[model samples]
Target chain A: MKKKIVVCTDLGPALSLLTLRDDLDVVVWPHAVDTECPRAWLLENVQGASGLVVCFKERVDGEVIKAAGSGLRAVSTISVGYDHLDLPLLASRNVQVGYTPDVLTDAVADSAVMLALMASRRTNLTTSLVTSNAWPAFQWTPFALSAPQLSTTLFSPKRTVGFLGFGRIAQAVLRRLTLGFGVSDAIYTPRPEAPPQVMRDAELLRGLMPNLHSLRAVDMPTLAADSDFLFVLAPGGEATRHLIDESFLRRMKPTSVLVNNGRGSVVDSTALAKALKEGWIWGAGLDVVEEEPHVGVKHVLPAEQGVREKCVVVPHLGSATHETRAEMARLTVVNVLRGVDGEQMESGLDLGRWQ
Target chain B: MKKKIVVCTDLGPALSLLTLRDDLDVVVWPHAVDTECPRAWLLENVQGASGLVVCFKERVDGEVIKAAGSGLRAVSTISVGYDHLDLPLLASRNVQVGYTPDVLTDAVADSAVMLALMASRRTNLTTSLVTSNAWPAFQWTPFALSAPQLSTTLFSPKRTVGFLGFGRIAQAVLRRLTLGFGVSDAIYTPRPEAPPQVMRDAELLRGLMPNLHSLRAVDMPTLAADSDFLFVLAPGGEATRHLIDESFLRRMKPTSVLVNNGRGSVVDSTALAKALKEGWIWGAGLDVVEEEPHVGVKHVLPAEQGVREKCVVVPHLGSATHETRAEMARLTVVNVLRGVDGEQMESGLDLGRWQ
Candidate 1:
């Protein structure tokens, strides 16, 4: 008998890679593109499945494990974050969890830089001036529409880029900043006892920025005070929640821009909004807000008032590029295809947690 | 008698560099910051000037030159272009023209990339969706807000960047593109008999993108046909006016973006608007339009309807960064100061046209 593999999200053509296998039965959710998979639908469909596919939006907790019963052996998601999955339970049951990590590092880094540029350049204000037909009267004075630049120039020769979490994505962002913008210095707060340096990236960064003055591991306060552009790329959870609060923001350069491209939970939206409103920071670009998807008028970051006037809220789209998303989907299918056959997933979580 | 240097516009504290020298008299346009110096006022004040400072806004035509009489020996503008000045007349009168170039190159190139990201990522669409408090209903499916990424990745290991003019700014742009985004290939059209390569940039590009597939000098048709992101960096005048018209735009890929960061005259705004409305190209990010400063609601590019929905019109702010503008102002003063004393201006334009 063919093993059943239930795919919860519309991962476009990547789903075909799974459905093509005659040895497995792939059950896909059929619906409009905009709507997410319903909880009941996932619980009902995951029954008697050897493998299941999910995006980050889907929940795979104890309730899901109970619903899928003992037959489920694999849970593959098309995202790097596996927060929704009950990992301990999965490990206890010998069920493997798979995710796509490095595949999205560059794409997310690109979006981070995009947010930085958009915020610093004040595209929101400039675009409004154009769309409202208020551009004709706009005169080009020496400083008109002027803002901080992403790149280093003769005037501001010592621009620094600081990353809250110096991991794969932050390293990628640093590489881009060094090469593209000629940033002179870098400061990052890596996780405790993180590898000092990846030799490949170290060599690459040096080659890309020959006159790179320094690259140092600094504490959070130094990161806040010294950064011309502070990027929040730390993980989301209890330890990191509100890490970039009022105290952190107060220490930042008033001319500096704050970009949060990681998780929304890492930044406090209320403090950030207040910072922007009261000129504690020049501008802000946020891809992930605390209360997202439903980041309506009431949300502090998108309130349409002074609090958010200088802030740019982007719907979390770190992996929302055609090529990246497609690759992620294919990788998701690949991970599940391997795991369901009782083999090792290309990028699977260590089931040794129950040890 | 002390030589008189008429500083026509407020150049911030960079003016102090000129004013501090007691060998010259300084005259500034004392008025509201928003208003440009009236033509009459400029004509009236430049009567016995030995050196004059102006930005691009003031037209240094026959009327102003005739008004300035024989005393005016230097006309230094804080800009790269000399279209506002009559070069033949200036040459005949033995007057020198000084401009600020190279200093603003990186800033403008940075803006070009910013526009590329903005247009391709649909920042206009996304920003509006965010600002209007309509973000709650936005769902993140695999392809939600998906657009062509600026960088090369595993899924798209063959992205190409094209330039209409391979000058300093375009080369700087290419450097950033290669370093920041990891574009795989580059193509450019240089002026006839322009040098094949700058060794430093060539080496830098090779190092930054070790897997750079190609860097070629191609013709216009091939540039249009081959590019995923076509940048219009060509000079503006009757010769290059409307160069990027309907025919060229139609030849462009549907996924391509046309960025005009060079000059307004090169791109025919009406043709671009139609192209955008009918989807001949995916999007356009224009820092310059055919009719600028006064590009009102009736203007083709900012018509507030179908014509510009997918287009992003930035008011010619390529060099409007705080760092770059200050550098340009200082350079402008240096040029005028040198020219006034019958010395070679640091970046003076050759007045050999009437030779």
Candidate 2:
């Protein structure tokens, strides 16, 4: 009998892998159906599914797992973070879990650095001025909408880069920040007893950066106070919620810029809105927001509500590059295939469970 | 016994310097006077002026210089380029000349890099989408408005940076391009043998950049073909007028971005306007246009003109920073003071006859 796999959430790239396997019955969700399906309807329909390939939006919890029952051998998510999955319950049920990691490091890092540059340069403001026809007659003025002087050692002498969580993406961002932007002296909040590779990478970064003054791990307060620009690259969970709040933003210098390429929940959107409204910092560039597609309205809403000129919001494009997405999908398929074959999965989440 | 100085234009930064000496009599023109003041009117107004501080709009030719007579010791301009000043006539008259150089390097370089970054990143398009509220609700397709991948390496196994001119501003820009953006190789138009210090500085830059594949002199065609992005930084005069016209722009790859931080006349704005309209090149960022204050309409006019969307035109702000302007003003003042004292002026232009 063929093992039936039900791919959810518009299985375009991820389902391409199972197309060649004759022994596996792969049910690719039609695009129209995926777009129009209600959550309750989806739950009622996916009862007899043998496997589930999930995405960020579709939550897979105890209830959903219980519905899958005994035949559901494996569950795979097309993302690095498995936050939406109920890990404890999945482990208790002996359901194998697979995730795609390390594939999107370059793309996320590239976006983070791009955001940093965009924030510091005020590209959005100047571009808008010209596009909106607000720019008046060309008269040389002492102060105009201009990019911050990055060539001179203006920010170098007091350079300090901060990361909320020092993971793979954070490390990659650090490398670009140090090498590409002449930033040194990083401060990060590491998880308790961080992995040896993380420490080794930190040491390696320090060695590579000649002007690196300090790379010490610190608490949130120290990180907020010292950093010229902060990168939020931590996980999105209850423990790490609102890592950057009102007080933290207030502590940052008026000239500093904030970039959030990580999870939106890691930052308090209301606090950020207030900080930008009150001019707590220079500006902000956010690729991720609290409520994604809906939050974009905040950028266009009235300035009184604090979502006007200073905030530059993109629609959650942290890892949206063509090359990166292809790599991610390919890696995710490999992980799923490996899990089904009873071989060691490439990036299997070690939940300490046995089948 | 006091030396008299007549400012043809509105009393600019140089006027403050002339006023410092109690022995010098400074005559300021009426603030509302038009630039097309006749020579007869100037002669009648300021009969015995020893120095003339004129702006680009005020033409200073043989007639104007002769009207100032034997008492006219120096003609100082508070600008870097002297295209407006008749150099041959000034040299023949034995009048000392002063122009500011090396002072505006950082500011111009900053602007150059800013234009490069802005152009490559499609800042204008992206900013419009966000501020106009045309995005978010629109489902993002693969062909959405996106920035060119600047991270794409150009050279085989390395990347190359090219410049139209190898002057101080261009060198500073090259520094930022190579260091900040990790450009490896460099190609610049050949110039006369520079001083030992310049050669040593180039050597130091090469030493600092490990991936610097080659730094050679190249012709315009080679530069256009090989360079990922081309910077027009050559001097503006009869020689360099329309240096980058139709053929030059067409030679560049469709993906390449062009930046003009030098004189507007160095580029054929008509050709550039058309190139961008037809997608011959990706985009352009220009600080200087063929006509100042006139080109403001190019940015402000209706979208039917097509120039508004293709170009990011900043009001000529190559040297508008506080730090740089102050420094340039101080230097101009020092030059004026030295000329009045009959001493060797700092940064005095060698007009051949005067030398």
- DockQ, prediction 1: 0.64
Q: What lDDT is reached at residue B240 by model 1?
A: 84
Q: Candidate 1: which stretches are off by over 4 Å?
A: A154-156, A192-209, A304-309, B191-209, B304-309
Against the true structure, what is each candidate's TM-score?
0.94, 0.74
The C-alpha RMSD in Å for every predicted model, in order, reads: 2.5, 6.1
Residue-level lDDT for B155 in candidate 2: 22
In order, the candidates keep a fraction of the true contacts of: 0.69, 0.11
Model 2 residue B338 CA deviation in Å: 4.0
> lDDT of model 1 at residue B111?
87
Candidate 2's residue-wise lDDT over B19-50, tens digit each?
A: 78799888766641334344566666556777
DockQ of each: 0.64, 0.18
Error of 2 at B207 (Å): 2.6
